[model samples]
Target chain A: MDFELSEEQRLLKDSVDRLIAKEYRFERRLDFLRRSEGWSRQTWQGFAEMGLLALPFAEEHGGFGSGGVETMLVMEAFGRGLVVEPYLSTVILAGGTIRHSGASGRMAETVERIIAGEHLMALAHNEKGGPRHSLEPQTRAKRSGACWTLTGSKIAVLHGATADELVVSATTDTGSALFLVPAEAEGISVSPQKGYDGVPLAEVTLEGVSVQTEFVLCEPGMGEKVLAHVIAEANAALCAEAVGIMGDVFDTTCEYLLTRTQFGVPIGSFQALQHQAADMLIELELSRSMAILAALSIDSEPPVRERNVSAAKAQIGRSGRLIGQRAIQLHGAIGITEEYKVGHSFKRLTAIDAMFGNADWHIDAIVEAGGLYTA
Target chain B: MDLNFSVEDVAFREEVRTFLASSLPDYLCAKMIKRLHLTKDETVHWQRILNARGWATPSWPVDCGGQSWSPSQRYIFQEEMALAHAPETQPFNVNMIGPILAKFGTDEQKAKFLRSTANLDIWWCQGFSEPGAGSDLASLKTSAVRDGNHYLINGQKIWTTQAQNADWMFALVRTDSSGRKQEGISFLLIDMTTHGITVRPIETIDGGHDANEVFFDDVRVPTANLIGEEGKGWTYAKHLLGNERSGIARIGLSKERLKQLRSLEHELSASGQLDERETVGLKRKLAEVEVQLRALELTQLRVVSADAHGANAGAAASILKIKGTELQQRMTELVLELAGPEGLALAVDDHTDGSGGWQNPAAQFYFTMRKVSIFGGSNEIQKNIIAKTMLGL
Candidate 1:
């Protein structure tokens, strides 16, 4: 087994690192967050120009054929920079769903547009009520001549307000299905808002929104697999991002400890604080391992892929919580201030931990499947 | 970037499993599966079988009777042994003194000791931690003074594991008194049967006599037993401890434990012992710990693979120790929890033999596992190392 990145992967990682280091400074991030749009479209186009938007699509689709490892590299850099682009919502969650579902015609051209930096999309799968993190949508779909009308509310539609089109999940008479519906389609309204971490989220209401029969991403028999695959991909990217955030928080805390002197010496010289910092580093490394493992497992068979992704999401959640808390405690007041980078890291971590499946929820899922091993 | 083992590694693993299946005695496997204590002879027997295959000391170089296995092959061998219910190669012989002697011993010392050490002809035990020198090992007062061609050893060593069964004890004795505490110390190999030496058993909370208080009253030892130069015992000890931390996770052991736990869960349902809710709760706890183990297992692979590329993330070493020991203890605790009322039975009897895993001393195993975090530099001490060395705290 090998863990070393390939030459191309390393080069890709270096470019992302350099781009983020040069442009996404802390002050620039704050300024971007303060804007009316809450993020930068210019930065989004810049990512497309860098070919990141094209990274995960297949070569047959006029895109660079890449896999989860490449996504891991990019997301990790985004985490380090605290970049607030719509890559996850647009590229992985929405565009990725269409690409992986093997949908041709309009859907395939949409993916082409996404790769060419001409389109933005968001996934509207999660909804309110029922069990937490339930993948089966409460949204309903109605049959119409040469069309389907969707009638349901999709809560927390990540980056949905700005998307050119939305990938919507709904239940039909047979089972669940997904459709690519235009954002400005009749009977669609979005309550636009920003998450606590300052990323865009919207409550998308689909009141009999009409979609042509041709826009069905998947039917009942195949939709579940595609949704699970894309969700795992998103979670893997998020896991990688969490690792990047944890690493930076850990390093920043260490720097603070070495320089933040009190009581006649650096406060870090205290055994209690030192041990906390050590614990943070341990969590960071473990989280990183889980992230890599999750990335590698994205293409495996369904059972293995789902189980590993849940395991990684849970582990990253737990580690992120511990590291974030320790970072705050170690830095004292500065760690929680709005101006400080560490607090922002903690907030992003909090959001990531809550998204898809939190640690405890994922643990419940694993046990529900009769644990990770058998006789 | 990949976790797939190569074709050669898979075959090597198969070879190891085949050897274990053919040669490992059922009686010892039974003891290992249940966490029952094994007699010293049983441990020696297993180690010899492995040694005869040239597999017992795979980490050592080929010249020292070790296999020329790559790191992954060696890892597979170690992993297979654990999965097959085989006992670990005696740490004092294989992991500790043997490597030191191979790395730094004189020609005569290597010729005399290396083979027997691997073959289990010399059952070695460490004599390091004194009553006062648990974590502060530098303060050890055990002394060796020169008497012509020999040195007289004196003072005491506590927590010498399996001392009663040990044929030899490798120790760090203070050879000079006028230097720093960490200095003036020497690594010595002493015959356990020597005169003026006494081994007093220290009964642990598990009710096992696995350790002792070894006292040296002017015990005479040849200067030839000295390893490398004098006053470098601390450096050598560090090397030995570093080796200990490499495979500290023991992922295969934890995996096997989880497998046994799952089977036991099935038995619990078949016996109509646990209610549905209780079964679900138990499974949840088991999955949490299993997930934790998987995380550590991947972390270990990351470290190992990084090492293959000549990038040593030694800082991740302490992560292994802390998480590895915690999972071990958690496993024992889970077993005890499964045992429940049956565990409280006063009779010292097992419901099943080694064939079905009923001889488990669940509470005792739980208590015994407590020593893991306390020993081998202790988790606290490991954190201190990480704090100073890795985190720059």
Candidate 2:
């Protein structure tokens, strides 16, 4: 029944907050974006040093045995600072797939590399017109004695251009499978995309790319199960991140209302604006509750956890738009600039909503399961 | 009451279409039709061809080499040029500085720069927006100090479009500090090759390099370069903005893009990219923008006709600025929607598979067109202008 963070979880949150204060200042975030990789390697290394990179992995895998709640703590802080590192792709999603997949030799070594910030991986599942964001990926994987070959196109893989490895999902003869393919493997092509929020995104294509048998993270039967769990974890992380963004946007807009003056008085004095600001606050609080729900329910039974995360993601998508736009409308011209914080927050919210699935898509998922309560 | 183009205006439209088909280069036409970027050389080359035919500066005064065309004729000319996929006439030369010189410049200044500007022999860029003075341009700190026969200019200007390729820059510099912030500004022209001047290209959000930040470290300019009276720069700046809003609506460009989007939608739908449900949603959104544009066109025509009757079109100009940009932006957003997630891939030329090349620029144009709402008196400012000037609030 207790909602208070554990002492260790409180320490984790504090560490993330400190790192953000030190590294993710708005100007420094812009600096990272200007770099070739569109993220800060030094900050990623710092995460490795702080043991934040290994937060969600088992201690046996050279990690801290943390779970979704710990990841939530890190993501919320990262969101407030608009951190552009691909932590969601590299750590929460791809790293989770590996940690839960029970790999023995090379795969465990890959997890170690990831914990050390020496390797970055992304899950490539979204296809152009694939069914339901590729829970059952259509990418064809064929085995030939000692090796497997994959062929498909992934439309939007976050940080796809910078990933050293990609956890690609493919369909085999019996069922779907997950393979850890080197990003620079033969017949692999990546075209870089400009993310709406300055996150590195790309269109990745594979044409008969050969993968060794040892690189298989999950066999045919386990692939779809692992992928669904990975996506649910990602959805939970994104919701927490969105809650942080909405809270920041609401706080800044209130500050702006107090400080920004027009017509010889602070604009916050007007009752019309006061009501709008209050509505934004309401949306923010509701989204926060949903994010917390997702974080706490991450390890529950399958249907409960999946339904909760989808509901949280949908709430974020709806609420983020209201809060982001309210911030912009209240701040006027300065809010939409590239240099400003509020506009970038809005962009990130937009990018979050677009990823995995948008609000309507998830709402449809909930309804297709005969609504949230039924699930 | 008559909304149709006159018989002569229709003939002029046909004449413009014929001339564009004959004169517009094939490569440039392809670039314009495909919405691809045109090189600075290609732009200047096209302007020179227009200049050779005495059609480069149609809106200028007849005494200053203008065609003395009616307002309808000019509209037809611009619309026809857009429809034919010709490269746009460089606005800095014709719409901006050329008309200013005709109105207020000294006879010698006109003789020195007018013909050269018209022929694109001297590419011009605006240097009015300083880093500290975007929407509130009167707060600019760029200094122009008189030293005998020369004025030493020193300060920075940002968002200066085409500064790298420009041969000259017309700028607003602070010449005095004793009076109101808006009163002490002076319009001055500085040659781009002047010593102690540096142009740094600023990459915009859309990954375009059309804007720059120019730094002046004690650059010297002859007093002859000053436009109009000293401390009257703000007045000229306002006048320049009025002219700037002339094509801000860019109706013809939007119409062409909408036409292109229609075809793209059909192709994607035929390829099973868009299902019936998605197609219905997209079609409805497209129809909404088309409806808004049609209404804007009527209002624009009313403004044109009202101008013919000597009524001021200031209120309608603000309306056009707001609604026109909204429709343009809405269309780009729909293209991004049609592109779905794949639109984020902007590297169109390199290894495009499973989708048309049109998908790449969907995100590019959506991110890039955001400037239309922010720049040249943001849509918010336009709303305030509408409220204060039109509504008497």
Candidate 3:
């Protein structure tokens, strides 16, 4: 019923917004983007100190049990700032998955480290042959005595190069399972990959990597649920991040239009470009709504959760592409260059779009599940 | 800060829902729910039901037969109507001209028009856009020359929707030729029965005569018919436009369409194996549209709520106008896509009850909606408003 955020939520949003606005400037990100690692450790430690890393975990687990909406607020601010931390990987993907699926002692320890900003973790789920969902994971895990050894490659592991722990999705004799292993475990090597957004990704090769029995985050054969939850969170987070980027796109474009004069007047005064800007505004607003709805359904029981997650992902995916493409189109050749921040935001939007489930993928899922109308 | 409805709002919501269920006729509700073309009688019947309950003009002031509910209450009431498939009060009378007259009408003007408009005693139409003055409305060339307590009007208006069915019209006409285009105009209320006034129906691509080209050849009108001062018509026109833009958004209608789309998707999915690309793509797009619609609705609520609280964001009204129309057009596009070949079929004898026959209306509707973004100040004008008024462009 009510759509307004609570005073507390608004305050939280303002705090996050102000923090990112002040400290996480694009110049710093540009500097970091040129480095081999996409982000600086000190900036991440500052995020930890600000409790950004701990917002999504339960209070009892030394974190805030903030739901998806709050997480969206934080991520949106991060995205607007273009903060180069692996918050999406460490906090949202691996850390969020473990926290939601009845955290084990080892998993809880990892969550604690992630929240403290002492360590990072990335979800190593997508195989080279599989799409983002890849529910029936290709990574194989065999029971050798009491311990399990996983052998396979996880492609495009987001922030894989920086993480200390890797949450690997594998299919065993019992079905799908989520295993948490050390990033530097024996027989595990990562080939660093640079995403279009300049974020560090890695194609991780696991050759008989040993994982303790207790490291299984979810019950055997119950990993599909864990994977679903992770996908939902990641998808929702991506939507939120895109909204932030889109906001910047609008802002940057608006400023450019106002300052750039044509026909002896600011182009912003021209109705044609003005109309286009209005449409972009509409798109941005629409994407924000999708992000909010997706975040709202993050904790809901399946099929409903799955549907909403797909809906959000799909909408955001389309919005990201539309806005990114439009931003470039509106900005002209200067936008395609490296100097303009709009280009960078455009790239980031496209990359977030490709992650999780793309718009088409989610739409298909939503249609299959009959989620188009009911939710 | 709390998003939860207050206890009074919850009670008011239930009251509205109950009234809509018990009071609005089933046939009319069915027409709205099924997206069937509603007869004038069906629309009038539901409007009467709402008027009888004194819930007809929630947006009007108490003195104007409005209940003067809080913004949140109005929001809840309007939302329930859409959710329950109850017919809406005709916007031409209730929203467009009524509010304009209430705000700027002379005492004589109010006595002559206000009551009839609220009760639907007189069907009303707008005459603003001329063939030349579309988005540049101030450039309207329709002229009203003063002559001994009356004005002789001569001009042509295009895209006048529902003019053929209307009994009265509120028009923008030039009153002075020497001043700036905006300053010379005036708002005039003209009876449809006046001599020298003609309405020629313009059949839209939708195959319906929803619009008309109205011509005036020296039509005479009493000076008393003018709302506000002669030169102030431009101001009143601007005021009327704000209302027009808001009404055009029609967030409630979008919600209804979205609901229909969801159900249709389910039926389609159940018939057989869905084409993975088509089915999923449609579902996700639906969700995406729903999200935008939701945000627009919330923005609308905030605006209405502020007005109810005696504050206003009138300057940002264009924001809703642009988004609302775009979302509506997008929804129609999706509906067309879902309807597939059936959507493309023209309304023919097969589908109509011999009244209109069977051709699917989706394609026609989609075509009609293409004008939504181009109308109501062209959304381009809206951004200008936002830039100057909201962002200080």
**Tens-digit per-residue lDDT, B225-250, candidate 1:** 99988899888888876563337688
Per-residue lDDT of B99-175 in model 2, one digit per residue for the tens?
99989899999999999999999999999899899878899999999999899999999999999999999999999
User: Candidate order by TM-score, highest to lowest?
Assistant: 1, 3, 2
Write down the RMSD of candidate 3 (Cα, Å).
3.6
Candidate number of the best lDDT: 1
Clashing pairs in 2: none
List candidate 1 stretches off by more than 4 Å.
B244-246, B346-360
The model with the greatest DockQ is 1
RMSD to native, candidate 2: 22.8
Candidate 3: regions farther than 4 A off: A104-108, A262-265, B1-13, B26-42, B82-86, B203-207, B244-248, B258-319, B326-375, B379-393
TM-score of chain A in every predicted structure: 0.98, 0.97, 0.96
Q: Which 10 successive residues of model 3 chain B have the least lDDT summed? A: B350-359
TM-score of chain B of 2: 0.95
- Give Cα distance to truth, residue B111, candidate 3, Å: 3.3
Second chain TM-score for model 3: 0.92
lDDT per residue for candidate 2 within A1-375, as digits (tens), equals 224467898988998998888778889998998998899888899989998888888888888888778888889999999988879889988887897687676666888999999999888888877576756777899999989999998877888998999999899998989998888999999998978898888899999999999888999878878887888889989998988888888778878887888999878766567656765654665576567767767877878777677777777887899889888998999998988999999999998998878877776665444334330
